[model samples]
Target: MAIPGAVGASIVDYTTGFPVATTGAAPNNDHEAAAAGTADVVQAATSRSLYVSAVPHDLLEDLIITTAGGYHLLRPVQTDFDSRLVLYVWLDRAQGNLAVARLRMQKLADELIAT
Candidate 1:
């Protein structure tokens, strides 16, 4: 998100749970590292749940999923065929809204940002 007071934001695919895009302090910080680590943790620990964990987010695919402190949102998108994908986002708990952020990600994903 490009909102003011935003600390950091990232798009992760829960299917392969990893960071796709990150805006803010990820370059120097371990934000991306933590994201990738969490994804692996989810995959190894909760693979049976509705939460589909992914590999490194940069590897790529059709899912857009997100994970933030106090929030984990998954927005699935549809293509012309039987394919399906989700949009993922990560935001800080104190500064982000689970509902509005999900909506925004849904809008972005609808525009084919999931790919």
Candidate 2:
């Protein structure tokens, strides 16, 4: 929750829809449901060919879902072993800087995979 406007954050195992860690308030006060939703969204995006990059070998990096209340940012944690994790953060649209939050999430995701 160090990031401005961050209402909730979670490190989810997309493959299993499991939340490894979570902090702050969940969307409906349920972290498990939020993690499952995160996994579903990521799965939908990755499964659809429309989201595929035109550039050969390019992969999906992140996703941003905008709601009236906040912005849902999802960053896939890429690792040398298995890249099945996603960092999800809910940011209040009025107070959050999307660009900065995205950058910070990218760094955090990298650090997560490093450890």
Candidate 3:
């Protein structure tokens, strides 16, 4: 994975605020809570985007949050299964490359949708 120092990854359903699947280490070792929190982050970002005239788009591609220790990437999955789904990836700031991680995440999302 190009997402260096990845701590965890998960597929979450924002509509229901639940994790569909998860892998790796999640915050507090709780994937379910992490997924739910990720859904909230996605919802807030999407809602804010609607009010911004700069980029008027119905679809939310991704949301990135950088902390002192790591980076969080929230990618909404455009799948036949559910549009409300999102892919969440956590990476260490020291090792992860944001640009590469974004591309890799997109690829992961595409593969997920295809399956």
Q: Pick the candidate with the highest lDDT.
A: 2
By the lDDT metric, which is better: model 1 or model 3? Answer: 3
Residue 91 of candidate 2: its Cα lDDT?
95
Cα lDDT tens digits, model 1, 2-72, are 43224555555545556766666542476567466546644544455443335434322223334444344
How many pairs collide in each candidate, listed in order?
A: 12, 0, 0
Tell me model 1's lDDT, rounded to 2 decimals.
0.51
Q: Please, what is the whole-model Cα lDDT of each candidate in the order they appear?
A: 0.51, 0.90, 0.85
Model 1 weakest lDDT span, ten residues long: 56-65
CA lDDT, candidate 2, residue 30? 96
In order of TM-score, best first, we have 2, 3, 1
lDDT of 2 by residue, 2-98 (tens): 6888999999999889999999988999999999999999999887746765677878889999998899999998878865889999999999999
Model 2 per-residue lDDT at 73:
97
Q: Which candidate is the best by TM-score?
A: 2
What are the runs in model 2 whose C-alpha is more than 4 Å off? none
Clashing pairs in 3: none
